[model samples]
Target: MLLHESQLAQGVFNLTWKVEMSGTIETGHVKWFNDEKGYGFISRDNGQDDVFVHFRSINSTANRKTLQEGQRVEFKVIKGPKGLQAEEVTAI
Candidate 1:
């Protein structure tokens, strides 16, 4: 297989680094949601299973207290210790 195709299949080149510490309203599916805890994971575009997003990262302007599972919303990635985390979640 071509390297590009392999990369695409493996979702390696798709990794995101938050150079700007900010991002546009790129949407992702909510994988699991816990309204009581106010935290959840989003299924990112590159097929990642779960990217953690806390309520604190959600924008107040969003006007939503909690997210529903499978809901698509835009967010930014913040570098975390083990991997990456989604932040600044906002509806678009």
Candidate 2:
């Protein structure tokens, strides 16, 4: 055997972008929902992928009444665990 050594890069190759939004009331209908589990998907404009929203993160009371199948409300964009959860929801 022979002595051997090597050096590797010391910095991370991390890349990320920021979510900036002064949100306003927007209409989004519930695509898939489980009221009992307090988790569901909302289909936004342009027909993009539905974003997941959890009851634990909502400012309103943790109940299905605070949300509905086709509710229109205003909220800010947040980088949540499941990605892009609505915050500070208020009726239009």
Candidate 3:
């Protein structure tokens, strides 16, 4: 669902759904990755705190899935258990 600024002004703060209301997608570079552990962090281009990324969150079409350091990517943000995390990630 799309989240317009006006909608947020109306107090739409539901946590059950992944919201991309702002109509903004983010791009970032992989800061580090552990192929064995299947987890890593991405340094957002906006200069925000690095976002955590998991192997399962990647959207890849290749037979082998792996992210290398300095790889550029686009992703959506979700409120994960620990905090904000990258989801629906795809290599850019």
Q: Highest TM-score: which candidate? A: 3
What tens-digit string does per-residue lDDT give for candidate 2 at 46-85? 4655666666535665444346777655555555534676
lDDT of 1 by residue, 1-92 (tens): 55677777556433544333436545688888798888878888766546788887777665566887878788877665445678778755
Candidate 2 local distance difference test against the native:
0.55
Off by over 4 Å in 1: 1-25, 61-64
lDDT (C-alpha, whole model) for all candidates: 0.71, 0.55, 0.83
Clashes of 2: 0
Kindly provide the TM-score of model 1 when superposed on the true structure, using C-alpha atoms: 0.62
Q: Cα lDDT for residue 42, model 1? A: 88
**Which pairs of residues have clashing backbones in candidate 1?**
none
The per-residue C-alpha lDDT of model 2 at residue 48 equals 55
Candidate 3: segments with Cα more than 4 A from true spot? 1-23
Q: Summing lDDT over every window of 10 consecutive residues in candidate 1, give the lowest-scoring window.
A: 13-22
Which residue pairs of candidate 3 clash?
3-21
TM-score attained by model 3: 0.73
Per-residue accuracy of model 3 over 1-92 as CA lDDT, tens digit each:
88789877555444444444334689999999899999999999999888889998899988767799999999888776566788888998
